[model samples]
Target: MEISQRHEGARGTISPSGSLVAHSSNSKLRPATLLSHSSIRTAAKEVSTLKWSSDSANIAIVSNKLVEVQAVEGHAHPTRIENGSGSLGRFVGADFVGRHHLLTSWEFGRAKIWDLSTGKGTDLGDLKTTCDEPAWQQRPESTGDIRTVALLTRLAAEDTLTMHFPELSTSMQPLKLPTVDAKSMSWSPDGRWLAVLDTATASPSVYFYTPDAHQYRSYPSAANLEGDGCLGVKAINWSADSRVVALSRYDGTVVLLNTITFTPLAVIKHTTTVEQSNLPPHQQTPIWREAVSASNERSYALASQPVSPPLSRTKPTIEPVELGVAEASFSSNGSYLATRDERMLSTVWIWNVATLAAHAVVMQHSNVRKAQWHPTRASLVILDCGEGIAYLYDVATSSAPLAVNAPLPGSPTLSWVHTAAESKLAILAAARSSFWILYPEGAESVSDDARAGVEVGGELFEEGASEDSLLDILSGRKPALPYEIEESYTKMVELEMGEADEGADVAFDDTFREKKKADTDAVDPLDDSQIF
Candidate 1:
């Protein structure tokens, strides 16, 4: 009510208040619309999950008690699926099978498929396992085509997997599995194989199978990746083609395996080091400490403070901590793989999937919250830097970072828009707010596939850009110096801007200062290599 009122009293009356920031003109993304889910109200729902359909026309919102399908273009769903008996044993997971069906699982060994088109529901037999990590195979390319979906649930009788045709209400051949607690699983891009990582203990045992559950190959324990050989698996992701499987441990060691033969392709150990860059005010980067103990609450469940030390933890370390891969993702084309060096603001590694070697080590950001490949482009990538900013990096083009002031309302989810004739991206801030980013053509920057990769950042070092050069480029990794140096540097930048009458844009002024620093600073040229 106050936002629409003309009566002036205080800050609420100001339409363009100082707190309500206006976006910069240098950016190409224009706000299109904001969609709010304020109508969603129910005590039974616990943090609803939102997923878009292949055509980007509908969204499947799954909550603790019900799975609701909402058409994105404001089309009403004429029929609703009957969710049998509310609160079905704690909703474990859910996903869209094809374009018209939503597959959901429950913890009490129950799995159900709901056909959105017909509003018909099918109940599969008891899964006999803790239902979690339910993933669907690649959807059919043709719209409205039935999708083949697989569910990996360990039954009390035996560890077995079930396949189903939600469209026809029929079950495929049930395949038996060897291990329980399948920590992670994913489908190959072609929908032929299912890769399952079963880490019941510290031993990282993995299995690959056809959709029918026929085991193709059993992989050696990535427990070997651990010093004690006891830590369980942290994360696993399949390449775009499903030919390669990337598995990571908590200690920042990434191991890639060939999906066909289940053989280790490459093992990259990510350890931080200092490097040489003469950009003034060189300071030593603090060592990344490993997580010694986990709190009773999950990391995501804990409330976040508005301000805290960038890389400081108060708990004293009695024993040495080990770092592991926090998150890992494959590019859309499976040409590149990126891993988050757990808990470290510096040290995000990119690898060439074809060569199975480290392609580039980017020690540039304070923290990389998330990384995902462009939907169509293989070399292009977008990174969410925990803060309100997002960066675009094109390893195929340059090694500079393009910063965008994208202030997401909550947890950031950046996805490419799949609508035809619209090369844009969408940002979903929590479940309430939505924003569309349109990089207009010929507007200095456009989201075109052919001319896309250019104008991106991260110094374009050769294929094997060594660790030293990357560390040198990262401001946080210089040599450890007193805190006053950082403070003085900040003061210097502020003073320079003031001397110039604050007439220039802040970004441009900072860029000019960095340019001047680069010209005056003496440093050895960066050396690159052909590790591939």
Candidate 2:
């Protein structure tokens, strides 16, 4: 099957089988179009396992846990310290600071500051309630109130560590803010300000904190919210210029706002019901309904316009956009945005700063999340598509994604190192929870050519196999796995919208409601009179 993608003026179309069509005014895409064509295949018939290192990468994934850290490039992975009987909270977020320090925080009540260059993890302190010390210039009394902290380390070589420790601040401090719960957090590109999603109020609002002054500023006020219906704010992305912020709400509303003025730039709404109609004649375009009628009247009258009769309307359906698993990320250049839904499909969308329509739905991933742009290049992106698979895509051409056959002994997470002088290579946290330095096949590198080549083929040795046997079995491999199978799958069958309807506007009546009601009502096997 040939897939064709095309751009026409402000809107773009993807013809999965050379038949798809859509219309839009703003460049930002509507979710309806994304769902119709952005179906990614989740099944990977074949996969490979990977090696690991924890210190050299920013993120790590194992089993159901994800770890984010800024470990030294050459040091051994830092030892994890467990305190009390509390759970060991998986690392949720991490960032490198000035090339020397790695900071981490978790959903569990703990945060740590580590020296990445020396592999020294200093418990610069815990946010636990017992450590509060007004005498030590530290507020240990406020530990339980803390929820999440956003750490910022501008460069790996920098000396400062900035953290949004609202939960640990004492009353004597100048900025005495409420006990806030952070749902999301981000830093300005320049690293001067940190923005937070404050869920402490009836209507959650974004708050800004300046590290130097230890003060809080409320830029966006509560009056701006439309209602409680807007509360499902799941994710946020920052513009590269630090002038705008894009937010995603669970209700399917994606909005871009002016960071300085706190004003909405555009709001992209989503819907699932397909609205079908015909276009008017080439000479004169009529209203949608009139155009449909005119086409049916002219049996063969060769009208100049192209039109078709209207089909019956159907009830508008709302397709659920997964709230929790989807994350918002901005391209390095800030010209576009990308997100992955819970269903395993990811999309790169062109962002029009002025209007909200998505100009193009660049590509989709079948089972990937965590996508980021090449720090020095404009078009390239890397993503982990679960199942030990990863992909690199060139946005300019929405063709087949470039496959990166890295071994992910198990599920893995990815992180990018920013490079000022060269295109940075991705650091993949290996299956052992360690990190590996990976350079794509054609990417430039200065390492010695004597290094071992990427292991492209292998078979997992049985439990009874020896180490030497395993090494010899997988070494110098070709068509390595004799038991592997190859097969092709048909493209996803389009979910037919609205059942064979009385008209296009009608909706299907659910039949299970009565059954559920009978189950909860008085036990009656003979409710036949009310069965209808």
Candidate 3:
């Protein structure tokens, strides 16, 4: 097959025998280059989810009945495992336990660890746990080892969360939760805290717990205060440092809380002005007349009809209405927060963490499917709007987001793969026939620099600073530094001298010219007698 590659300014297209083509438009930010595209056949045509191994060498694609593990670096045959037997039920989800082992869960709260090397599946004991979705503790620093996994199970007429250590084959004591209906759970990046979101309560709350199943505190959502009948949190995101947590509520507000002190920091409300659809009398009268004429023409029309007055002409007024937040996430360094509202599906709000102000607003033509920050780079975000294009926003580099089109057909889902050497993105097309991996050009050095900039005194700058220090700095309550004081004094003195010099020059020059002109005029007036 003949392959053709074309480039026009910031845009690029690749065509292979007209079967597949990839297009990307350049921006101030670097565009992702299509590295590899591969097609694989599966028993099921749809893909439920995609996950990358910690090493970034393999990817696990889960379907309804089977799990497919594909290698990224080679042309190796994909491994398919169908562990769904009599009581095991269907495969719900799968996560990489390590580089060689894969943990697959079932609908009946059963789990199995499949060894990819030997093609062996070992089932865990009858734990009767709810494995609908398991939240694995993230350990970025570890060597792809399964540490602790949290699973939910209904016990004693209430939903209970339990921890299981896969390697040791032991489970932790069941932790009693405040709400019986826990919507979801998330572990901090450092694996220090676990946050469980409870939506099935009078007031939705987010409970914080230690890794050892110790409940520390809970923050009840403010959604019920609007008298909206127990609105819940749609999403929860923890800052990279695990210090601040953002809760996206269904009441159109995002609450940011200080996890250290368990107090609210700010409540961000997203409001949009909508024009009322009340039409003017002139416009309504024409439509009413047309309808009346049409009704009179009908053969079976009623003889008596009620006459209705036309509405008075008035200008439409715009009123701001709050929109529920659909998604919210913090950047890698916690410098920026990105949120998407449910009503306004095509717009993204990027807020500055330091100033609590909007840094950028990204509007797309299509509804956005996902907006995720880079795993290692701060202020960089990737958005997929199901338009076969990926929009990238890097606040540190540019104000405008860049667009990169996928090589495959249909809407594609995105997953970021971070490795020791570089970071890559996996785009799975909607058809599930093929997938592509893209690597952003010139992103490695930029990511390295961003990671280095956030580290201060051998600890993350966000985690090292105390709450009081940050509050004082943000509120402008700190004392001025010596250099700042001296600089202010110098600037004040310079401004005063400059103004005085300008005033003196104008006054002296004007006074001297006026005196000279007066003297000449007076003499001329007296000497007029000689001419006579």
Candidate 4:
């Protein structure tokens, strides 16, 4: 079935040799649709990414050499990006910032925005090549894609840049806070607030921006968030309902804030040990220091004084959320949050959005590929837990989740498509030569058996001495993870890897000797004219 208006009619694939071929299928067992490369263009250029216009009338195939936007109807010549431009660099990705503007990221780490209406492109002006915040201005009513652009340049005490449309009009305004070298700043998804994080100071320096009120509030000023999140905020997520925001920190602490009141709703501290390094426990400093010291621009007397131990190092404990390779996804209903982390064990934590409490912890063996809630079923969640295994975690009932193992397990790549109409959720997992979708219900898998088995939050991988619950046992002895305790050091590890080739070890001592002898006998005509 056609997924949407833009993806209607047929499904397509781009070959490694850079060819787009269409395939048609009404169901999983249907025959494929095919087209010849000779009918299209048969050149062998590597395609880095492909993007569709919001309207789905055009598809852009991006590569190091060019960006070609092809019409869906396969009519006329594709709009080639390099047709007239001479300074275009090798691009690895493309962002359709607006319908009329295309932002291309270069291999050199720079970016340029091109205006489709005028055929003119403007370099984002030598901004940090790594800044990921080049975004189009967002307004619910503004849909035609002629939106303005906000370009973040140097994070070290920088200005907020706005480049107007058509004329490419420009404006610059310094950040409302005195965060010298902002380090990183992000606008909430709804574009209602901007959160600026500064790592320049010895402690965490965070600020929030409210555009309508033209107000900037520091972390300490926000009630309840005072003295919170010491290891620094790593990422920020805005709930779709636009009521609350979640700030996750390096220490695995999560703080929630209310938009309307600018107040902290909850502070979810991890089951981690707080170890003080440089200063003794008595000389500690609150992570959320006020306008004190050189942390924030507003001058305070503490900057010149010695460390005064913080009033308290205590935190309120909740269920321990593991630290992973940094991944979290909010449910479509905005009522749940799923998080995966890397630790001695791998787990998926689903939390109730309103209470910020763990509703379930899905323990498994494989790294979680993805966890997304069903579009229509608030209690249903689909999980892609590597090795062709899928699970339907129904929180509505406290039973082991339904399990379905597919035939494909060799794939190392998988991603979720948007939740579709009715109750369907599409999965686009990479197979051998191409990628395909698994059924919304996930691989003809029936619900797991009701009999008791080794289970972790209702997930069963295996049970044996090799799989002892060491961390679970250690956590159980602590009563609660957030109790105040003196800082202590645990462990440190340094890893080094050397690059070696299998064929590099072939005997070359005799070859090197012969080459040296040949060089000694060779004449140097250029040496005679040297130093002129």
Top candidate on lDDT is 3
lDDT of 3 by residue, 437-500 (tens): 4544533334543433221111111211221121223346544221121222224446887899
Where does model 1 exceed 4 Å of error?
1-47, 63-65, 71-77, 84-94, 116-119, 128-132, 135-146, 200-204, 221-228, 274-323, 407-532
Better of 2 and 3 by lDDT: 3
lDDT of each: 0.49, 0.38, 0.55, 0.47
Please provide, for model 4 over 1-532, each residue's C-alpha lDDT reduced to its tens digit, 9 standing for 90 to 100.
2111122222344222121232222211111111111123411145555666555444566666666554444332344464222233466667665466677665544556666544456655444454344333332224344454444455444534333343344434533345444456666656667666655231435677654324467664634443543446566666666677776666556777787765678876533232345666455422211231354222212112232222111354586754422556566667877664434123556678876676665555445567766655677777675666556777656565655444564642444444434544544545534445555453322244412211111111121101112222234532222333321111110111112233354333232334446554552211111000
Tell me model 4's lDDT, rounded to 2 decimals. Answer: 0.47
Better of 2 and 4 by lDDT: 4
What local lDDT score does residue 295 receive in model 3, on the 0 to 100 scale?
37
Q: Alpha carbon lDDT of residue 7, candidate 1?
A: 17
lDDT of 1 at 86: 42
Residue pairs whose backbone atoms clash in candidate 4: 155-181, 155-182, 156-181, 157-180, 157-181, 157-182, 323-342, 324-341, 324-342
Q: Which stretches of candidate 4 lie over 4 Å from their true place?
A: 1-44, 74-76, 83-89, 108-110, 132-146, 155-185, 200-205, 210-215, 220-230, 270-325, 374-378, 440-532
Instruction: Give the higher-TM-score candidate: 1 or 2.
Output: 1
Model 3, residue 405: C-alpha shift (Å): 6.4
Across residues 1-532, which tens digit of lDDT does each residue of candidate 2 receive? 1111222222222212211222222211111121132211111111111112222232211111322221212222222222212243444434333234445444443455444333334333333222111101111122333322333221222212233443333212223333244444456665555655545243545566553435355433555544654454566677777777776766555667776665678776532221223522332212111111343221112122232222112343586444432566667777666654343243333444544444333233233456777665656677665545556666545343555556545565554434443543443333332223344543443444323222211222222221121122234322323423222111111123424343466443333445456454542221111000
Weakest 10 consecutive residues, lDDT, candidate 4? 488-497
